[model samples]
Target: MARDDDTLVQLLTPDGERVDRAVGPDGVEYSVDLTDAEYRGFYRDLVTVRRLDAEATALQRQGELGIWASLLGQEAAQVGSGRALRPQDMVFPTYREHGVLYCRGIDPIMPLSLFRGVDQGAWDPIETRCGMYTIVIGAQTLHATGYAMGIAMDGKVGGDDGEAAIAYFGDGATSQGDVNEAFIWSAVYTAPVVFFCQNNQYAISEPIERQTRVPLYQRAAGFGFPGVRVDGNDVLASYAVTRHALDHARSGQGPTLIEAYTYRMGAHTTSDDPSRYRPPAEAEAWRSRDPIARLAAFLGRQQIADETFFAEVDEQARTEAVRLRERVLTMPDPAPDSIFDNVYPHGSPLVDGERERFNAYRKSFEGSAH
Candidate 1:
């Protein structure tokens, strides 16, 4: 993959140099005008997010979690776009968006419960402005489109206070019927939504090239919306491009598709063995463009953060990781009968009878050691 492709918007180079200006193929000039403090904050977020992912991976290896989908190399893509979202905006995310959930004020421990098989993530979507993690590939796109259409119907767009929706999916999901159907509906209704695709170059074991011949962003043209591809490892570029697209949506310009070109530096999940399908050389090559390292380099070069500051941030991240692990260890398992707790707003006779039978079945093994 050519990192310097003309169509890919990049504001920060892998060498830690800043591109003063970058114009996307869509004719939009993208740049970040963040304060020195904000730049340092972005660095902190990148480091902390990466540390959290590492901790989760370690936990999965230790059997504390059933599985984990890491955002190892995609920290910049998630943090940048996540911070770009307004408080009024809503987000629908696939299972891998732990970084986004962090940005949404969700406790890092919330997702662990889901993976641990104790409970569905119990956070309130309305309160957090983020939906639950959707495990069904591209299905969340359709949900986001429907919610965005509702926003338009409620006359909640086209103003500074207007709301927008963002749906995050992966490159492989573009091939799904639900994703394509979402494009059709959002475009026809001019729904206030942005489709954010982290094109990590693979949909599990399958390379992206196997799914589509053309660039993923180009598909937006067919749906009558603008699409922009950003250097996902460049936090500045990701933030600028996402901010623009989200603003366009809130202003009632309809939907935009943002393809964050990045790489999955880790396995699809703790259960996957990327070594079987991915070339080691490819992973090594991408290591040079690591999102966290690039941002750290930029911070050091610009004097935005000193060695002491970096040390303090690192310590903080380590402390948080330890605390999260402790929390996960102490999480009590829900009662087996709790699964039937939320089946309906009003309990049904059929479900009541089923629960009774289930309890009886459990009592059958009360004193058995088998």
Candidate 2:
């Protein structure tokens, strides 16, 4: 897919029009092919995922979670890119890629364990093909780059069956030295990785303009790779563009930077106050471009989905929310000793010493019980 330079690439519009295939100026055709049912499924995924975020945020407000990162407006950016990945592809996510986690077949409740202050990360990264959410700003870029290098070292490049990795970060992360270093490594080694930056218009309280003078995707050129910016709110566009990038990387084309230009419609997290840093009108503007609403509009206009289908999805989402709420409430508290168990794989004497001390302290209390 050749990217049009003048504007962000878009296949589905906010007003419900679907542009299935369009020829770029270079004579390359960019298209999206999905059955009506598949399109409706995307709509349902968006709704259900958004509902999941909303419910998680509410849980945080009620003290169920210590803090929650709401992926309110950026669902399309995450889900679109995530669903494009093959099963062998591994995902390195920041703390906010809940939509991607859903696409990766991870239990939505798993990350809650981290925020709810129960466990570190409950899922097996190898089994799920999704790494645990990295909380550090841009550290996962390095990890993803190293993983991609390993793929290359293992001779897993230049083929359709080759394994690839992707690192998901925000536009703000582009400024971090770790991200820059990762780019250099990826470019030099021609690592099979995709650097996906969801430029959600804000990096916490700061704006994207504060991060870079040029668009985020263009930065990839400096690292000696191709980059493209897409309409992050247009799920079809995001999915198509990401699929192309991933295929390119898997085929030994090296790294591609995809800047999903979208917006953050809510607070940075449950603990954040976007109202202080953001204006109401700005959010109102993005509101009209809501990802779920746009897809639903297209589905409705095309007669692909009816009121009954929407009703069914809504009901399903409600049931999911209820079940999730119950699961969260009933989450067992982590064992006191479990924390030390995961601190080291081979075992660290410092950690072992601390664990023994704690065990002795507990035994003292037990001795008093006699």
Candidate 3:
């Protein structure tokens, strides 16, 4: 059977057209419906996510954060899939997924603490249904798979009650052994988890071609589950596809793989320079397909919004930027003893020993005359 790379439905094209693909062997016709309000909601999601990205980048440059990852180009991909998740669903994310964190009701400030070198993670995962943004590349996938297995064992799967797990990873992480092992575990146990991979063309300085020759969605077939690719820049398509896949998993249909085709318009992090690895022309080309601009254009063409409404959104975005800046700048540094506090729940013998030795050293310094 021939799979449709173009079969996955995309309501808003990069050129801003309302079109659909014919059904093919892959069942590519859109399986979900959305309202005009929902479309506008997607537009809002993209805007705020971008605003947050801009704020984080500025914070990094101002030295408020040790480093920051800018998700300027992949806003649609993250927001689309993120909005699909229910409040009960748990999400494990990579450090770059500030968009996902925003969708999960976590304050944007939560991530700032990690980069500010103040604390490990500021938000409580159980409270927000979001995990700490894992910085170790693909390692969090295994944790997600384990959580899915626990969910299944608790009879959370095969129900309409809204419990599922999701793991967010990047193109660069696709090569990690942990990600592959997660596939094996999730498939064998039929875990109710969704693996959302944002293939933004480059994995740091390396291109996607360096990772895999085959389209990533095709990899799921070998793992014994369904896989689909959607225009990551098309927030509507991304939301619809992810909602369908999560619905499938929640109803005991097993895991689904989603490859969101998008690009990273900014540097990998504040410390890296894109000019060294990417050409100016490539950046300029992706800029033309700016996900936020495309959605704004579509909303205007459909009369879903007017010039005044768009101006409001732009104003609101700037306001958000200012608010984030104030909060980030005013954020207090964590106390010195906070470092050893969260390392253990009760206390570790080694930790206790270290604290004793450190206290003695400090006392010795106090006794010495300068």
Tell me the whole-model lDDT of each prediction, alpha carbons only: 0.93, 0.88, 0.84
Worst 10 residues of 3 by lDDT: 1-10
**What tens digits encode model 2's per-residue C-alpha lDDT throughout 1-370?**
1133454778988897988765432233567888887898788889999998899999999988999999999989988998899999989999999999999899999999889989888889999999999999999999999999999899988766888999999988988999999999999999999999998988899987787788787888888998878889989988988888888889888998988889989998888999998889989988999999899889889899999999999999989999999999999998787779977779999999999999888778874755
Comparing 2 with 3 on lDDT, the higher-scoring candidate is: 2
Model 1 stretches with alpha carbons more than 4 Å out = none
Per-model RMSD to reference: 1.0, 2.9, 2.6
Rank list by lDDT: 1, 2, 3
Considering summed lDDT, which 10 consecutive residues are worst modelled in model 2? 21-30
| Runs of candidate 3 exceeding 4 Å displacement | 1-8, 20-25, 359-370
Candidates sorted by TM-score, descending order? 1, 2, 3
Error of 1 at 149 (Å): 0.3
TM-score to native of every candidate shown: 0.98, 0.94, 0.94
Runs in model 2 deviating more than 4 A are 1-5, 22-29, 361-370
Error of 2 at 205 (Å): 0.5
lDDT of 2 at 169: 94
